[model samples]
Target: MTIDAKTPEEYISKVPEDRKEAISKLRETIKTNLPYGFEECINYGMIGYVVPHSLYPDGYHCDPKQPLPFACIASQKNFVALYHSGVYADPKIHDWFVAEYPKYVKTKLDMGKSCIRFKNIQTIPYELIGELCRKMTAQEWINLYEQNIKKS
Candidate 1:
């Protein structure tokens, strides 16, 4: 669903009723565990955590006007998605998550480069997500982004 929300609360309010609680919990989990320096906002139409321009004035390479995105949570039509740039950029973190996922949820991991899809809302592993949020700090993400993602 395309939600044109200006704030995180507004974004949650626009999601499907069934997904509201899960999204809210996921938001809280991310907020509670994410390292300092990342700000929460509505980014790419989803509730996102980003490295503010104050910390990384260069901003996102794709759109310099925007902050450097670290993670995001979206309630899609078929599933709820958690997008973590760290997992996509760091192979160690990726392998760790992949190895740890089966212990938390019975279903096979459904993931893309950065997007982890939770088709069954009840199966969403909030704790694992929280731990993932803490795996990389804003400065660490900025370094990784510069080395692996941002083009010259």
Candidate 2:
């Protein structure tokens, strides 16, 4: 995915035309499903929905300003990836996710510490993704972020 962001708007603008539409869709999904006390910004060269420090003073990875523990959407050369740090840290969440969203597994999926990757927009289970986002409360996210930080 292309991050290349100097600013949020610029980041969106920089996305290739073929992937921009998918990114736009993901952006809308994130906005519609976001939890309270989160902010949207361009981070790590992509669209990042952030749980700001004010909400979690310890912040992501306990670095305060670093990480930001985001749900990041990116348009990559090979695929689009949805980054959810909090979700990746919890085995129960991960297992439940696969069980709940079988359609996603049917698609081209990749795993990273916090990334869910797809070859294209058609593979994205937007509704389910939204549900997952909605289910992740701020407290759960902060706790997960802290846990992940300590592990790192």
Candidate 3:
């Protein structure tokens, strides 16, 4: 599902009707728990939370024009996905989320480097996602990205 949306609200409006509520809730959860300094916008065609350029002028190493992305939520064709850069960059957070997942959802965890796919939207663990959002602040993400992701 490629949604050509200029804003987060537009993205949400374009998602499948069945997924609107879940995506909205997921967006809300991320927004409510994400630490201060992260701004919400449409990034990479998804609802993205990023560290604004004002905070990190260098921006994303891959694309200096864009802000430093922290997290994103999107409704895909088969599932709704949550992408958290911290989980991919930090082993401790990855291990913690992996161990804690079974406690929340019965379905087997569907995850990639940073993408967590929820095939059953009803099974999406909003609370755990919120906690994950709160795990890293913007400055911390900038530090981690510099050390682990950004190339010299």
Give the top-scoring candidate (lDDT): 1
Cα lDDT of model 1 by residue, 49-151, tens digit: 9999999999999899999999999999899999999999999999999999999999999999999999999999999998888899988999999998999
Q: Provide the TM-score for each candidate, comma-separated.
A: 0.98, 0.84, 0.98
Would you list the rank order by lDDT, best first? Answer: 1, 3, 2
Measured with C-alpha atoms, the lDDT of residue 29 in candidate 2 is 85
- The Cα error of candidate 2 at residue 7, in Å, is 3.6
Q: Which is better, 1 or 3, measured by lDDT?
A: 1
lDDT of 2 at 33: 89
Clashes in candidate 3: how many?
Answer: 0
Give lDDT tens digits, candidate 2, residues 1-152.
Answer: 45667666677678777777777877888888888877888776778888777776666564657546668888777888888866677777777777776765575346676778877567778888888788677777777666655555
Judged by whole-model lDDT over C-alpha atoms, candidate 1 comes out at: 0.94
* Predicted candidate 3 versus true structure: per-residue lDDT over 7-85, tens digit per residue: 9999988999999999999999999999999999999999999999999999998899999998999988899999999
CA lDDT scores, all candidates in order? 0.94, 0.74, 0.93
- Each candidate's number of clashing pairs is 0, 3, 0
Cα displacement (Å) at residue 44, model 3: 0.8
Question: Which residue runs of candidate 2 sit more than 4 Å off their true CA positions?
Answer: none
Native-vs-model 3 lDDT? 0.93
